[model samples]
Target: ALSVLMPKVKVKKNAKSGKKGKDKKPQPKVNTLISKPKAAASLRRKLSGPEDVPVPDDDSGDLDEPAAAKPAKTKLKAAEPPTRLTRGQRKRQQRKENFLRKFELANLIGKQEEAFRTGSLANLADLTAHLEEDKAPATAKGPKRLGRKAQAAQDEREMAQFQGVLGFKAFQADPFGALEQHLKNSIRLQKEKEKTAAGKQKAKLSQLKEAFRSKKRLGTVKNKFAKSRKPKK
Candidate 1:
């Protein structure tokens, strides 16, 4: 009777007013490291939506469409038959046979697994010993790096390939003076052009003087009245 009355009173109060704590919003999650960017609403943000899907030129539902569209399939693959074996395949088959033979000799020491499951304590101990040995992890070793001489030879080959004819010509044309003489000649011609441009101001000033003189009657004065003043009246 007391428990029923207690819940009824609390329900009546909840109906009248909601609790302040209950009304409060949950806290937003805070990232301690990298956070995803809020995507902008358009293509300017560099993000694509599902509707902006890219369509390939040959998007036909057939798998062979791309293969058929490809030009002549110019791959220089050897024309060996699929059933043929390369040298590596032969080596792998030999290795597999050797491994199976070695495994058979090793397993001959132990009887069938069923015998051990229903056998004496000594057999049980031997099985446990075998399992323990199998579980013992082997130490793995990495391949050794190339020696200094090997590395130097590899770098020399690379340089010879990339440097090709340009480097060979440079070395042959001038062992002591690379292409410095040719570079100097180009610089000298550029400086001569600059000097000619500077002298153009003098030529331009002489042209201006000639143009001024050609604009008139000669004497630097309008003295026609002095020459003919009615015979000195």
Candidate 2:
């Protein structure tokens, strides 16, 4: 039954995800471009001073108010009221909690995946459980971050070992030596391409020079000695 349902369920899922969803991978959310919100925040910071961290001006959710500054009394409106849920009030709270927790976890997973996809410095260590020894001393704080060497070695071994698993093996099966080799090949290929381009440019320059000389020679040749026009000074 599970075997029979698997393909059908997969088909339904795929059908739900139309053409655009099939091959489309979620974009990474880390590195070069952080989340859009982060990028927008950075822009806002640049435009406005650092203090432009738009403090939640209206803790009060007053949608009807005008855009301009409001009086303190205006900030407090009777129409706006806070909402509270009772312990047992929500129907199917257990199911809702289960679904909510699952959804939250999925969202978190997608976020992390996006970060990884974006080629951010994957904090693989966070994936593994850590102890107090792993963290820095909280008391002595300055520009608190992992030092150069620690950050360098942080997930190096872990990543390699993880890659050593079946997935890594599949990757290794690819002609590309460890992923680093593929990267190195890319850099080498780019440099070689530049070199080839440079060579072509030189060849083109040489051809142009040769063509110029040929044109000059052809132009200067005796035109049956009829029109011996003097060359322009």
Candidate 3:
């Protein structure tokens, strides 16, 4: 009765105003937690649109071009067969190699000695120049075949020169023999000195032993009393 007495109010219902249409399909939910890089790349691809790669036609002029237009490969040369050497040739080569090896050793030894004497590093160029000057003869003569004696004399002269450079006394023709003789003489002298020293030592030992024996034979107390009592006048 109190609601009837109040003013009547109309309430409008909330309804769809647009015309009815077919129901739209719901889209699958995309993961929002995708990596930033992947999302960025996908966004870029979408913006760029589909890539269109050109397909080559088989009948094109490029296919008809000459094969020579491409780079050609270089062929390697075949190895040559080794030449056979005669016994004499082989022997000569061996001798030459041996000479070179000996020359190198001599040079190294000379350098070392020079360094030791000078207390400084020896210059290779200067040493080589000195060696060359020493080797050079006064006259430029043709190669001559030398006899055994002549060769030996030449060797002795060269050795003497080398010794002189090293501040050693010039050695005889047979340096080895002279050195051996010097060693032998020194040994002999040393032995003689030893023998003389031994003889002197033996004499001294014998005299001491004899004196000791005599003293022991003559009683110590009797000898002392005899010495103390003077000879009767």
Across 60-144, the per-residue lDDT of candidate 3 in tens digits comes to 6575577667677899989989989999999999999999999999999997888878977546688889999999987878799
Quote the lDDT for 161 in model 1: 72
Ranked candidates (lDDT, high to low): 3, 2, 1
- Candidate 2 lDDT, tens digit per residue, 15-54? 6645445464555334332346677566656666767335
Runs of candidate 1 exceeding 4 Å displacement: 1-176, 214-233
Q: How good is model 2 by TM-score?
A: 0.23
- Top lDDT: which candidate number? 3
Sequence-dependent TM-score of model 1: 0.22
Residue 98: error of model 2 in Å? 86
C-alpha displacement of 61 in model 2, angstroms?
A: 89
Clashing residue pairs for model 2: 28-118, 29-114
Model 2 RMSD in angstroms: 54.8
Error of 3 at 136 (Å): 58
Candidate 2 residue 27 Cα shift, in angstroms, is 99
